[model samples]
Target: MAAILKDVMSPNPVSSNATDELTTVSKKMKEEDVGFIPVKEDDKYAGVVTDRDIVVNGLAKGSAENVQASDVMTENIVTGPPDMEVEEAARLMQEHQIKRLLVMEDKEVKGVATLGDLGVENAVETAGNVIHDVSKGNGNN
Candidate 1:
């Protein structure tokens, strides 16, 4: 049987509220040592705020102190089920040009699967392909 997302995903990722200030979320990211955070609205999964989102959308737009997670979060996020095959998850990440894949089950956020997670699962080649594909057209980054 193939490995599933649940077998390699980082479970119970720390989350932030849509109303949270960028400063607060940045602090949380520092504390957790993670660049990504799932954002919640009304206790429901709403979007995601990444370190890039903070710099590109939050800091680049206005005073960082006044910015909220929702102000910079990446909505229309890509998501997958925990039971999804790891290869499928890699394909999904590549297809979306995203480094992280939200794991959802029954309309609830369950975990997050990252390229590093896939690499650690012995899918290094697959992870590398995702990185290459995502970097394409991303431009000078």
Candidate 2:
């Protein structure tokens, strides 16, 4: 039996605008209790903003209010499809060194898949390897 991304991904993930203030995005992240948020521009998926990007790029620039999601968002994001195999998704995460992957359908944002989601599906080893690789700067660190 092949487990698909839609079976384990967090659907309809919280998102933000690329032009939004970093402070606003940070607040949303805090409120959502999430470390990452999808970024959109012109109603189209643009990139991803992570807590690290906030600290490293946003704060480093002086004020969060002065920073925009586009200023800190990772534009070259690796996305996956809803029907993708879990193992393949895990592999993509490992390859990208990213902890989360935006699940897209027809070029539209659909959901997100995290290493923890894989762990929840009993892919502990895969999740661990992903974490290790991402932590070691292999994914996007």
Candidate 3:
């Protein structure tokens, strides 16, 4: 049987509100020691904010204090179910050229799967391929 995401993913990932200021999101990132954060809106999982988003969209634009999480969050983020196979999730990450995969269930953010997770889970080959492809920057950024 294939390893599922729940086995390797970090559960109950930290999240932020869409209406939250970028400063708030940055603090959350710092407190959680995570670069990625799921975003919520209207009590629903809406999007994601990353450290890069804060730098590129928030800081690069204007005062980060004035920017909301929604202002820098990636709305069309790719997601997968907690039960998804590790190999399948790796493929998805390679295809999307993204480093992280937001694990979702019942429209709620369950956890996050990352290349490092794959490596830690003994999916080193898959993790290597994903890292290589994502570094190529071929997918939509």
Tens digit of per-residue lDDT, candidate 2, span 11-85: 998999999998899999999999889999999988899888888778988888778999999888888899998
In model 3, which runs have C-alpha deviations exceeding 4 angstroms? 120-141
lDDT of each: 0.84, 0.84, 0.84
Runs in model 2 with CA error above 4 Å?
120-137
Superposed model 1: Cα runs more than 4 Å off? 120-141
Tell me the lDDT of candidate 3.
Answer: 0.84
Best by TM-score: 2
RMSD of 2: 2.1
